[model samples]
Target: MKAFGSIALAAAVTLGLGGVVLAKPLSRIISETGLSPEDFEVLSATSDSMLASGTPRAGKEREWINESTGSKGTIRVLEVRDNCASLQHFIRPAGVSQTRQIRTRRCRDANGNWILTP
Candidate 1:
């Protein structure tokens, strides 16, 4: 019985579908895209610029401008998968004259939206 329980746990983590995220079947599910680490950074920085509280829809794009400092940028959802999402954020800080790109991921919670996990 103990061994069976352990096996169940292992299976859940492996398939990712059972644990959270996508409603698709086991075969189509994945835990991570393996591109998350680098992508997630850009997403996080850009999302902060939006100053809104909600999950960005997959493929949704938004533009932002900082009125005070005149910094501007864009954020776009690259993709969304079972449990997590990939996003891109571009920013050109005021007075620096350079553009930056950041990519990041967000995991779903009980509320059914992508959010950065602790």
Candidate 2:
């Protein structure tokens, strides 16, 4: 009976460790936005600039600017599974308006390469 209990405990410990290994890191999800470090820096700068300029532009226009500039601003990592991740980017105008915009995308990290998933 003692041996059986010990074996069960060992099994449980192994399973627990496996679960942790299978879990994904939050940063990995953010990394999947197909954004390089430079891209992230540019996005942060653009967001700061927009906020400072107090521009009240349309959401579409803001998205266009971000996309054109290759910026993935304000991304939130929702989930990470295997090499794929789900993310969302929120954009808010810099003025005294309560407008908020959100965009969602799925991306994958293939062998350390990040790419947007179709």
Candidate 3:
């Protein structure tokens, strides 16, 4: 009985942590960042090696360049909290050897819409 109780407690703790990890609010990140849903359309939903490594391995770089500025960066959806969603865009100029992370804050517009601030 004691062993069963321990197992149940462990399962409950694991489930609780999993729920928190999965329950991120992404909408608030978008609204506060001022990134329209349309902008996300151009972003890669998943992290790709080309973007992370800064080398075009297989994907067409031209398409990304044509869609947006020729900026190389990572676009990720970050959930700041339960009520906020944010898209984190990290950009580095082409041909640059070093990488840097840029932060953009989200704010509401006059109509209470979220906007991303540089």
Model 2: per-residue Cα lDDT over 1-118, one tens digit each = 3333223322322233243334344344224333433444454444333333332233323332244444433544455566544444443323213423333323334445333332
Candidate that scores best on TM-score: 1
Task: Count the clashes in each prediction.
Answer: 9, 0, 14
- The local distance difference test score of each candidate is 0.48, 0.37, 0.36
Which of 1 and 2 is ahead in TM-score? 1
List TM-scores for all candidates, in order: 0.49, 0.32, 0.32
Q: Ten-residue segment with the worst summed lDDT in candidate 3?
A: 57-66
- Report the C-alpha displacement of residue 23, candidate 3, in angstroms: 37
Question: Per-residue lDDT for 40 in model 1?
Answer: 28
Model 2: how far residue 36 lies from native, Å: 19
Put down candidate 1 lDDT per residue, 2-118, tens digits, no spaces.
Answer: 333223322333333233443443233212221122232333444644324555568788876656556666778787677666656565655656676555555767876445432
Query: Which candidate gets the maximum lDDT versus the true structure?
Result: 1
RMSD of 2: 19.7
For model 1, the stretches where C-alpha displacement exceeds 4 angstroms are 1-57
Report RMSD (Å) for each prediction in the order shown: 13.6, 19.7, 19.0
Stretches of candidate 3 above 4 Å error? 1-69, 109-112
